[model samples]
Target: MHKEEIVLLHLTLFHIKRLFEQAGIANGHFKLYDSLDVQPVHIHKSKADHKKAILMLCKGITEVFKETPPDEVLRNPKMKELLEVVG
Candidate 1:
């Protein structure tokens, strides 16, 4: 994807992240999906876990938003896989 496309997706992901936080999902992992365990049994989760968890969270949220209409974001199909990674 192009730089502009990435930026747009990032903006959408950020909005959904704020919404999730407001909804009471505070693990500090939503910003680092692949790094976070995203489980309640993990008592020794590290910063790396948190990072991966956030990435996964954002990727999922971005996909869901892409399928739905945009209220505060521009949904698009071309950006779904762009963010579904551990990077």
Candidate 2:
């Protein structure tokens, strides 16, 4: 990925992480698997509450991205794709 795209991805993930934290999702975080052929991003939470945490994060994705800047998000195609997927 280009530097700009990487930056945008990180920014978006940061927003998502913050949202998860605010929502009280335990151990909420993002895992990037760029070197592998897996999904580019994965949301992870404490195994003790894995299912509930993941469901909450999935449900909150759209709201989280809605607060992010469109221009910065649109600058990276991957970010745009992710937004669409989440919504």
Overall lDDT per candidate, in order of appearance: 0.47, 0.43
Question: How well is each residue in 1-87 modelled by candidate 2, as lDDT tens digits?
Answer: 553454445445445655445444423223322222222233332232333334444444544456544465455566555556768
Task: Indicate the worst ten consecutive residues by lDDT in candidate 2.
Answer: 31-40
Per-residue alpha-carbon lDDT of candidate 1 for residues 1-87, written as tens digits (9 for 90 to 100): 543444444445555665544543333535444344443234355445434444676676765456554552322332333234322
Instruction: Provide the lowest-lDDT 10-residue window in model 1.
Output: 74-83
Candidate 2, lDDT over the whole model: 0.43
Which number leads on TM-score? 1
Looking at model 2, residue 50 earns an lDDT score of 33
- The reply for model 2, stretches above 4 Å from the true place, is 28-87
Clashes of 2: 0
Q: Which stretches of candidate 1 lie over 4 Å from their true place?
A: 31-87
